[model samples]
Target chain A: MNPTLDKLLGGKQGAIGLAVLAALILVVFPLLLDAFRLNMVGKYLTYAFVAVGLVLCWGYGGILSLGQGIFFGLGGYCMAMFLKLEASDPESTKIQSTPGIPDFMDWNQITELPMLWQPFHSFGFTLLAVIAVPVLLALVIGLTMFKRRVGDVYFSIVTQAIALILTVLIIGQQGYTGGVNGITDLKTLMGWDIRTDEAKLILYFVSAFLLFGCILLARFIIASKLGRLLLAMRDKEERVRFSGYDVASFKIFVFCVGAAFSAIGGAMFTLQVGFMSPSFVGIVPSIEMVIFAAVGGRLSLLGAVYGALLVNFGKTYFSESFPELWLYLMGGLFIAVVMYFPNGLAGLWDSHGKRWLTRIKPKANAPVKTEPVAKPVAKAAPTPELETTP
Target chain B: MEWLSEFGAIAAMQGFNGLSVFCVLLLMALGLAIIFGQMGVINMAHGEFLTIGAYTTFVVSSLTEQYAPAFGPYYFFFAIVLSFLIAGAIGWLVEWAMISKLYQRPLDTLLATWGLSLVMQQTFRSIFGAREVSATLPEWLMGSWNPTETIDIPRNGLFVMGLTILLTAIIFLMLYRSRWGLQVRATMQNRVMSRAVGINTKRVDRMTFALGCGVAGVAGAAFTTIGSTGPTAGSLYIVDTFLVVVFGGAASLFGTIASAFSIAQAQSIMEFFMSGSMAKVLTLSAVILILMMRPQGLFSIKVRK
Candidate 1:
């Protein structure tokens, strides 16, 4: 019985344990927290989804996509459109409170909704669009950019430019896309009162579940043969291309996957918050997502989640407590994180944990040799890369 | 005959507006081009420097209104100089403390500077509320000149154009003629070789960054005369600034000037017919198309492998 227990707690058993722990945390967290706090946590977890995508693309794929916000915004707007349609009077197809149409559309006198917005009226279609739109856009962009071999700073500039353009586009199409004010004051989702405690809890649970599922999927991909190919491409793009692999295709695949993840995050974000706007897809939000991944440590999926939580929690706290000083704190944190903890919070854990334990128990040093066997392989791989490279 | 004359007059007015936009774009892009082209850092906080300058100008105007009415129109000039210094000092400090450390990782600098930009924006927002501040332009700067009864050109816009030319000449001389300029160029071209030759590459980097930021501040000061000043005014210039830098090809002042002229003209001309947002969309679409056709931009510098 002891031997069976040991086996269950060893090797792949540890990963299973971590997964179970994560699942438990996700499932039980909202139950403990109040509705307001749970909603906020849900938003942060949605951001984590975007950060996780960034970790895969920017962290591992060596592609600095500054337009993840564009995907996030697209997903959000999609969901918002459907929710707005759902909440509207069925016969009139317009909410009486929102005169003519959305505020932006009032100026243009767009009394009739555009043909494209028709699909969004359905909950199921809107849900599909929340995933589909960002992925489709990312696929197109990735295909063009990677196929042309636009990497490094050039890719960064192009993506940033794309984000700016998208923001402008959304803002300009105020009739359909709610200009700068964005779509807000959403009261219901598929006949459920979104403002109620029960609905908020449900949304929180969905976000947590989606986050966990994404982490698992990301882990699976990272561990697969395709994941190895991605790492090889990141490490040596030319070599990978020379080895008969379609580097562009691989990049596009990863980029699309990342975009899909970000879209799911965005969908969850809008549903929880009951709002969507052009601000979500702006350059600032995009940069913020990248920073979350960077400060958390890009190499590990867990790092992305941790970074999003830490940075966002800091944002909420600072913005609420010391609004003026928040920017300074954020800047200082960015500089400190980059200079001191390039590997992020996870790196700090790996570096200091052993020493801390040793200091606490000097007599336990006999088992020092056995400690290496228990360490995650992911933590070990990065050390060689750091030493060998810059 | 009357309709033809009216069309001609409208065309001329738009041409002047295009030139005005070009002047602002040129000033903003020159600084970005120097940083991105010379040193491979895309200083995302470049626009925030502009904001600082604008705010400084606003404060100067307020101070002059309250305490020193005698300073009058010249107060704008004083604000411009002070803004340059203030922005430059901050830029230098940032370069020395944070940016200098991240030279090995250019992309990381993008994120760091972005964070810095946000902080600056929020700081400004907290200090000056979210509403747009009316930057008081002296009567002399506010009025327009009527070359003909039908053709009225803004006096301040003309000032901006003249300033653009003067600043361009000054920057050209400073970059090419000065000894420090040579050292900066040397470091920009090859850091290892410059170090081997006993050049203070670190000092050059800080100075260059500060100088670029100073130029951006000046652009912002110049901008207040034409546009509204606010906490998020910097965001308006960000896209145009990047477009100018990327389209001009990084590192080349000549390319920046050329791209700024072309893109600004294209945007203004399109704006004459279409809505402002549509015009921006058209302009960006043109830039993307251009980039697709010429990935290296109009002027590609020779990079040593």
Candidate 2:
């Protein structure tokens, strides 16, 4: 092996080995764990989807979108709406009289299904809508925002305001949207009985598969030129603009991609949980998304996944074990994360990895660093030039 | 002519209601403005601080009901003070423990404060049992003051208006005229220079944060008179409070007061004409349009680049 490749792979081997071990645990542990625990992990995996999107937008694109929940909620609601329609008894013309119309709708006397809810009866359309609606919303908003050069704190505030408005809008539309009660009592997903243990296991497997796919996709994007351009825009937008890149297009693209990922997460979330509500898309949940990404290490894609799982697991455990003190504990955790670990857990591992590598191979690394610049530099430049020429 | 007279009476009632709403909104936004305007920290827990104050008021009122029935209406005054202190103490603790560390990182503070709000909410829920606490109003606060035969304004609302004006004046004086105000302004404008000038920047941050929380607490106390108190009640006010603060511009005190007056009036008028939820949606949509036009908000001061 080349000396550079040897050095790169040498240090990463332990971390990669640990990751593979963790992956094995994840896949095998579900079989051994109870259905409830499997379901919890499934939920965490769905959340990890949102976290991955957040990492792209916030970690790489320099956009602190505190409205991932809105997209997530939108996707979930879309799926739930379909499931509700499918589950509704067609013989019962008195849909309004039906308790399943949601309590708020029953209160509102919405006797008939709204025209917009008609397409949701189809599973395929519902799936498509789950992905389409949030991405479309994000595309429009992102285009407008980025075109106006809204960034930093201003961008965060705008997204937060959007999340707030979306929540309120959903709640206000009591007739069709189910208002505060939201869409629940979901019995099935595309003919599969959702309540069954076997179905639950399948959902968990699907969630795990989707999560792995998202991680791989995110890693692929980060390795691509588009990701490089995004990072460049984040680090120095004006410089990138001067270098002939459409910064707005890049931002809008990444933002839409992020929104789509969040929507997918939401769809999976609704399928697993059998419910969707306005509460999930509100300002509080949106902020929680940011906190998860932040605590996990926004810079690393893996960190985002780990962070979501850890924070959510903590939330589930704390809320169950110590319901009253859960909030205080979460608050304390946030404060501790912000004050002490600005670079987050991933940064800690990165530094430790470097230190360990140096201790193990100090002599080998020293000679390579001091003796090696000419050949690599000469070889690296021509590859980029060849790509550009082509 | 009779129809016009009926419309006039309705409008007048709405105006008074709007003013009362404005008072609470302005008070809440005043604290938000001071923190965001001065320190640039979007304190998401500001509403929770208000909830804390309302809870304090409930505790005080309960104590008075138990111990000193003769004191009666006067218990409200004690509750107001105690609420302010309690909320302020929590604010101080939050600032010292969490917010102080996230000064340069305003976005981080927003997330941290949001977490704090959730914790506060859950704590209150665990303690208060997730139900609306019905606060008893004194006889004086119960009835409406009849300005005309058809138009009657609630006495409590009028009191709230008066309290709002008095607090605004006091806050204005302290922010502009006092030595601490000078230090605060100096620090807000240039932290390094303020520190160089021997100002205790950290102390200013704590005190300012506390002062803002105290105002929110007072607003909470005032709110108990008009609205039901519950663990989740704070969430209702948060969006409205943020709208007021953002509409007014984060740091501009006068802007906060102005925006509160305008937004409250608009919302009330809209509510009279439309459904409550529709009115809120309309008002928020209008605010968004206005923000897109003027992102700095109305009466925004140009800071040094």
Candidate 3:
């Protein structure tokens, strides 16, 4: 194997893992599921974008932000605003009091578009704002908290508070933010209808490809020297500070990166789902996003994707079959995962699944040289214990 | 001067409303502070414990009405005590089953307790049918105390405030002037040393957690007088309760009261001027900004480790 290829793909096992996941989503899911079901999977993959980011920030960087939904909502809202503006052209919205503004604005009796919503009219600006708005918010939050060394449980609580605040702000400013119902009836994007079946299929493939790009980007970050520093900071913050590193800067960077990933996911979500709401910007959704990362094996980028897919599948299946049982099961999953499976699905695979693989590998006449998976991730073994001790 | 007098009356009314809010916040924050400040554990299900108390009170009220109509008015007092006991007992059980295993992992405790809260919420929905329920207050708890022509204060507000004062005093006395308090403080400062000195540190932890949850239950009972109880009512206050505890400095009992008082007053006064949601947003934002500046909170102690 080429050294560069080994480094890029995290060895042959990791390469195979990536291929299998790609096949499962891009080929298998699309082929098997109908358009509606395929759209739902695409929606779940969008969340996987946020999960992959959490792998870096929460898993490796040791910053568990319970407010990723804020970024996701912002990204979605930005795209929705652009789409809403296009949908409410003077010709189409001739019936409303205000000929060109969104229907909600007209109902609220606003004659002119608010200064805040002005820039979102441009598709180019909306696309940029999707990532930029969330990153900017993350930067502000990260600078204030990380610079002051506010972290762990305190940081989580503060982020949760921010989620609450954002939700309230959005709801209170209903005239501007569409109240609690969020930005809806996002009919078109650049004159292209998004509600059609063909459009949904195209959007699904687009989301899947974007998600792959994000996963690769995360993998690249993890393979860099900065990844080692993140791990080091997580294990021993004081020691890293003592070693003359600006510990907070690295944390801020990783957090901003996580925010960007979530924002992209949010944008894709608006495109596919047809609306964005404050419901997605609140504490519950934020915490649920964290669980996606937790269930995926926070340390494993690939595992995060699978975690999103699996948990969402269970959610749809259970909620449809037995609505009451879903909350119980979800609550139980949260407890069980933390208590028993701290490292999540990938951890289980590393411990149990890899053994089965090795057993079958010999029988299949595979070379014994592919034994590096065990050694590479062995450093992760002590982290769960370390987290508990802290 | 007439308008000025009217403004004065409005201020007085809103201030009293703020005071009632302060009582609820203080009651909620006290329990959280004890668990978070002293025990260094984040019980995310603390709010659900409050809900448990509310439900317990509801059950007691209905039972009293059915079996003993004459005992209806006095049932509230009994319900308050029962709420505390029931919630404390559940807290004790939770500590044994889950919290003890997670004593070392504070973050995991947050997630697990959150899970516990979800389960509790679902259970409430299952039992209570998801509709908001209110306890039938006795005749004395209804109506208002008219201090003047323009100033009318709800009798229930005064009752809750009085209850809050009684509980706060008891908690202070217990923490400062009791043997159990000493054990809790010792365990808080140095668990190993406390254990070595013949203190059953585990018992202290369980009792401390139970005590915190019991206070939350009492808060819930008090809550029934002012507003209706729903499955998610407790969760609505959880974030605010946390902010109050955090803003007050996690370890300081006095700070908790002061912070809760200030925050409640600020929010209520703002509500008088602006939308309720905006008031909430402003209050929380101010707290977060101040917290960012003084991350140790309003009155954190400096201890040399």
Which regions of candidate 1 are displaced past 4 Å? A1-17, A20-24, A91-108, A121-124, A185-195, A242-244, A357-390, B59-78, B123-139, B177-179
Query: lDDT tens string, model 1, B1-305?
Result: 98888888888999998998899889888778778778888788899999988899999999999999988868988988998999999999989878998998877888778777877888889899988886789989978898878889989999889888988998889888999888988899899999999998988999999998998889889989888888878867776788788888777788888999999899998887889998998898789768766777788778874
Give me the candidate number with maximum TM-score.
3
Model 2's DockQ?
0.39
Ten consecutive residues with minimal summed lDDT in candidate 1 chain B?
A: B288-297
True contacts kept of 2: 0.38
Best by DockQ: 3
**Candidate 1 residue-wise lDDT, A200-304, digit = tens:** 888887788788788777776776678889899988999999999999998898899899999999988989998998889988788888888988888867778
lDDT (tens digit, per residue) of candidate 2 on A102-172: 34456688766678987887888988898899999999878777887864776787788778888888888
The pairs that clash in candidate 1 are B37-B250, B37-B251
Ranking by TM-score: 3, 1, 2
Candidate 2, B97-168: lDDT as tens digits? 888888877767877777778778888988988888956777788898987899988888888888889889
DockQ head-to-head 1 vs 2, winner: 1
DockQ per candidate: 0.47, 0.39, 0.84
Please give each candidate's TM-score: 0.88, 0.86, 0.95
- At residue A214, candidate 1 shows an lDDT of 85
Q: Alpha-carbon error at B157 in model 2, in Å?
A: 0.3
Ranking by lDDT: 3, 1, 2
| Model 2: CA > 4 A from native | A1-22, A89-112, A121-124, A187-194, A232-246, A351-390, B66-70, B122-136, B177-179, B196-198
True contacts kept of 1: 0.39
- Quote the positional error of residue A264 for candidate 2 in Å: 0.3
Docking class of 3: high
